[model samples]
Target: MAKPVQLTWLTGAQAIRLHDAGLRPPRGPFAYALVCDVRDPALAALANLALTDADLADERAPSASARTHFRARRSLLRALAAAALGVSPTSVRIAYDSDGAPRVDGLPAFVSVSSRGPLAALAVASSPLGIDLEPFDASAEPVDAVLHPREQAMLAELVSTARARAFLRIWTAKEAYLKALGRGFKRDPATIAATCEAAQFSIDDGGPAPLPVATFAPTMGLGDLIVACAVTA
Candidate 1:
């Protein structure tokens, strides 16, 4: 039987410590989701962790802050994947697909990642999955560029604050779904329909059926971020 999905929340420092201690995820048909703060200073030490030449080539960024964030996120992902596969972090090789989605070499697990500001989210599952994170902006409103007509009409009915939250819920859901499909924005956001009601979230891409999408409940320390995950189900 497939294992129930496990969700892990970690700081960059905690991830580094866990990796050093050789901690691993539960085995057998595992699906894991991890969310971390990539801005943690402790992650800087991870720059010394073993990375493929390709990974090193891609590490070059225009700004120091961007480089730091990239290294932290990549290092955390390698740590998580290594733990999941019960291998050393250095043995885990990461490659990217044409869509720029990260893939663990020789591993069947499907992986997806997203980040906004200091936060990063990762999803690794037996089946295809996608995860997205976005900071909550109370003043942000739905835009015509990305919203479906139905979504716009739905948001129009809500008050300002509610509209902002609802827009993010929809936006993240759509992004996650597209990522799951491995198409990203190649599929127009304006063409996908997404909805979040109460504790439930759903997406309809005009396929034979709606996609399975979920919105993570607001955690104490992450109250200002909107997180969503989509998986084939």
Candidate 2:
């Protein structure tokens, strides 16, 4: 009988098994992270595999680079999830909700994935959550577009490179929380105030209270990249 297992290879990327990550259900709680270069030559074989009918839709996305990254990252997503769930990667069905959030068909765990530059990151948990990773690119996105005026003023005081890195850190944090809330772009990013220094954020969505957000930089699998995750309190 074939036994599904977590695939770990230090040469290509950082991988964490459920057991190694100490993330077993009914055992309180734990985190699972896998960070890799989707464009790595070593991952070519996995990325080139055929896509199912459903996945093919996402593969058809415009922009050659994004298309490649999408196919590669999502394919590997199945492989990682299968390793954690002890099933064949191909058989691990992935279904997207109306909001575009992905659900690993057989598991009840919350999952999120993000990719940028040379890295792709993912996480799964027993609770609702969101994860995001982005490289520091000062010109890629404008901080004023998503950050509160007060936060932008604070960012403006930092040196050039440091400011960009800080933007990414705080931006990723905001994204992770929005993802956790399943609001995506439905909620305004500028409405949330985040402090990368504190690795936390807060926002009030007219619910008569503010959302208690638990955000952090996950150091496990990230290599030369900025990463963050958000879970409700």
Model 1, range 139-179, lDDT digits (tens) per residue?
98788799999899999999888989899889998998888
Off by more than 4 A, model 2? 1-12, 16-26, 41-50, 63-65, 138-142, 198-224
lDDT on C-alpha atoms for all candidate structures: 0.73, 0.63
Location of the lowest summed lDDT over 10 successive residues in candidate 1: 1-10
Question: Candidate 2 residues 141-233, lDDT tens each?
Answer: 445989877678878888777777777777777887788776787889998777543544544444554554444444544454666666553
Measured by TM-score, the strongest candidate is: 1
TM-score of each: 0.83, 0.72
Off by over 4 Å in 1: 1-28, 41-48, 217-223
Enumerate clash totals for all models, in the order shown: 0, 0
TM-score for model 2? 0.72
